[model samples]
Each structure stands twice: as structure tokens, then as C-alpha cells.
Target: MPMDWEAEFVFRAILIGVGATATMDIWAVVMKRAFGVPSLNYGFVGRWLGHMRHGQFAHESIAEAPPIAGEQIIGWSAHYVIGVIFAGLFLFVLGVDWARDPTLLPAVLFGIVTVSAPFFVMQPGMGLGFAAAKAPKSNIARLRSLIAHTSFGFGLFLATWSAAQVFQI
Candidate 1:
């Protein structure tokens, strides 16, 4: 039977998403253990999302906000779902050929672009201010965010390449 292109893209995109997210998570752990830098807790992510319900799109400090039940679950789920969405976007924008040949630059560029979410939307909404300007170590935070996103780009590349190899797609 001939394979369906739609099914292949969806399946591979999901695999790539999981791989990329895993890579990002691993990088976060390594940074924390090796450099004493901390990663954002998903609980804060949950809190931020939860409050988005009451028309509260922004906060002064998500950590200082009231906790919501299942915030942790919500945050973690959002993290993974966002990853899958990014993977889908990558595939949609670059097409399946990119996945088959797997270039690093495009993947990395996409990863950097994704950082805008945190720099603009997430950071400000979380009350860290734009680009984390309100944070004590704003520059450091910005750099870390860059590095993390860059790592995610690499993750996307590796994931897509691996998937292509495994599925021969």
C-alpha cells in the first residue's frame, strides 16, 4: 500500500516535536546543573495560563500570583503542545524536503525566531517586562533565552534528520 503524505507529515512532525522538546529540556537541566542558572518552572507557566481566563493577559510577577489547581499539569501540557505546534510550523513553512535533506541554518533560524515569543509575549505577560528588562539579570536572561532557543533549533534539526532516516521519508 502507498503511504499517505498527510499521515507521514503528521507522524513525523510529532516525533520531531517530541525530540526537539526533549532536547530543550535536556539543555535546561544541563544549564542548571553546570552553571547554576535556573529554568522557568512550569508551575509559573500554568499560573500564567490559568489567569489568562479572567481576561488577565499580563502579570507583574507570575511567581507572586495566586496558584491554580492543576497549574503544573497545564504548564507541562502547554510546553509539549507548543513544541508540537512549532514542529508543525517548521514542516509547513519549510516543507517536507527540508526535513529530508535537513539543513542546520534554517532550523536554527526558526529556533531564534521562536524566541520572540518569550522576549515579547511571554516575558511581558509574566511581568518580567519586555525582554526581561525588569529582571535583575536582564542581559543574562536574554542571553540564556537566546542560547535555549538556539539549542531548540539544533534539536529540530536532529529530530527531523533522525526521523527521516528512521522512516526513510
Candidate 2:
């Protein structure tokens, strides 16, 4: 029974993560079509990870980095994996009960807080500087990130709410 419960928990977490990440991607598409905002190139994320294997953590510009084999696939896979991990973290922090009956504020806050990953670790490591301070338009970049993460939070809520309704949890 305990194992079954654990398995179910893990499944729920993965579902929530994937759903939230997909929501963010949808938002990116909408932004691109409606406002001409370009989405982040996940290929760069793969390149950064590939370089890290060679002890090269920072790059002047990820775009200029030598392309790694299958970088696009690697980056997209990692993106989804990271999303699942983030959802797992969210579940751990909020507990299974939240998954059973999710709310908006907490999920949204968690999503917004996730922006710190890019602002601090991912951006600096990719040579964008802290919080994209070095970007051509840092403010716009920051705002976009905020909106994306907020959307992820909303995704989390939507996923959980839908799950609760379907699973009757």
C-alpha cells in the first residue's frame, strides 16, 4: 500500500510538471504569434549542458557556442525533465494534499519563484549575466521571464485542478 501510494504520488508530480511546462510552451507560441515575441531557444540550454561536460560552464554567448550533437533533442528533453523535477519539488513543499485539492496562490507563487533558476544560475552560466542584466533589453527579458513563470504557476493549478476532478482525489 505504501509503495502504491508513493508510485501514485510520483505519477501525479510528473503529470503536473509536464502539464505546467506545456502551458508555458503554449504561452510562448501565443506570444510569438500575437506579439512577435521570440521564444527562448532550448538548443542553447543543451549547448550549455554539453559544454559543462567539458568543464566549460560559462559562455560569452550560448548562440556562438559550437553545436553539440543532437543539441536540440537534448535541450528539449532536459527542459521537460527539469519541469518534472520542479513539479516534484513543488509537491514536496506543499504535500500531497495540495495535489488532491490544489489552490491558485501557492502554485502561482511557486511558479514565479522558479524564475530565480534562470535569473541566477542559468542566465549567468550562459553569459547573460545575473537576471539578464547584460541583455540588450534587460527589463524586457526580466518581464518575459516573470510572465512565463507565472504562467507555469497557473499551469500547475490547472493541472492539479483538472486531475482532482478526473481522479476524484
Candidate 3:
């Protein structure tokens, strides 16, 4: 049987995306604080932004504050919106059948594209020089971020598909 199109599901999917990404950021924070590793926490993107006036580079190492209350809020919002968009695209391609197929290719593509927004605006503002591309030692960090985002896309497809089934929508 063909599945029904659902605006509500799509919206929820976006919400899920936002929640999931926020989870990623939170994990990142825990990793940094617990281990003293300077990993990219959720606030990493936005906080670097706070330093723009001083010509601080995004890739430059700096002290980290305890996770800010605000960054998580904004970061989660961004994640949800991006997730909604990806689910929308999947809906467009697979129609209601996205619940069935949920191809990884399109999801990954959507993620790569979504990443460009931060790369263009936040990265430069934070002094990372074009999505953290401008760092003298940016290659690894850039690749890692890319991989993480792609993983996010994959997670979206899996979660949405699974949710669709579990909800029996």
C-alpha cells in the first residue's frame, strides 16, 4: 500500500533532527570537559563567532567555557530546521515511500549542502576562513566535521524510516 503524506511527520522529523544534533553537540561538550580535548562542541561554532571583533580565528585554540545555555538552544534549533529540510527533500524524492527506502545518497547530499551554510557564514565570522578551510592545519578538522555531518544525515534517514514504521504511519 502507498503511504500517506504527512505534514506532521515532516515537522516531527525536523524536530528530531534538531534534537539529535543537539545531542551530538552535548556529547562533544562532555568529551572536551571530561578529557581536556579541544573538540568541536556545539557552542564551538557560535562561540568562535563571539570572538570575531578581535580577529580571532575559528581554528585557533582558545579556552572553553562551560557549555552556554544559549548556544545549545540556537544550535538545536538549527539542527531541527536542517533535519526538517532533509526529510522534506526525502519526501519529495521518495514521496510517502521515504519511509520505505530512505536512500543514503540523497540524505548525505542534503547534509553536505546543509553544511555549507555554516561553512560560509559562521566559519568565516569565527575566522576559520571559509568553513574552517582557511586554517593552516584545517585539513583534518574540516574532514572530521564533514564526516560528522554526513553521519548526521545517515542518522536522520535511519531514524525517520524507523519512526515511520514504529508509528505505523
RMSD in angstroms, all models? 1.1, 1.4, 5.6
TM-score of each: 0.95, 0.96, 0.62
Q: Tell me the lDDT of model 1 at 39.
A: 90
The count of backbone overlaps in candidate 1 is 0
Candidate 2 runs further than 4 Å off: 1-3
Q: Write the per-residue lDDT of candidate 3 for residues 56-138, one digit (tens) a residue.
A: 64443423423334765555455556656665665566565565556667666766666676677665655567867766678
Q: Which stretches of candidate 1 lie over 4 Å from their true place?
A: none
lDDT of 2 by residue, 1-169 (tens): 2336677689888899999999999999999999999999999999999999899999998988899998888889998898889999999999888898898999999999999999999999888999999999999999999999999999999998888888754
Please list the residue runs of candidate 3 whose C-alpha ends up more than 4 Å from where it truly belongs after superposition: 1-6, 15-38, 47-69, 89-94
Task: Quote the RMSD, in angstroms, for model 3.
Answer: 5.6
User: Which structure is stronger by TM-score: 2 or 3?
Assistant: 2
Better of 1 and 3 by TM-score: 1
How many residue pairs of model 3 clash at the backbone?
2
What is the lDDT, from 0 to 100, of the residue 97 in candidate 2? 84
What are the Cα lDDT values of the candidates?
0.90, 0.91, 0.58
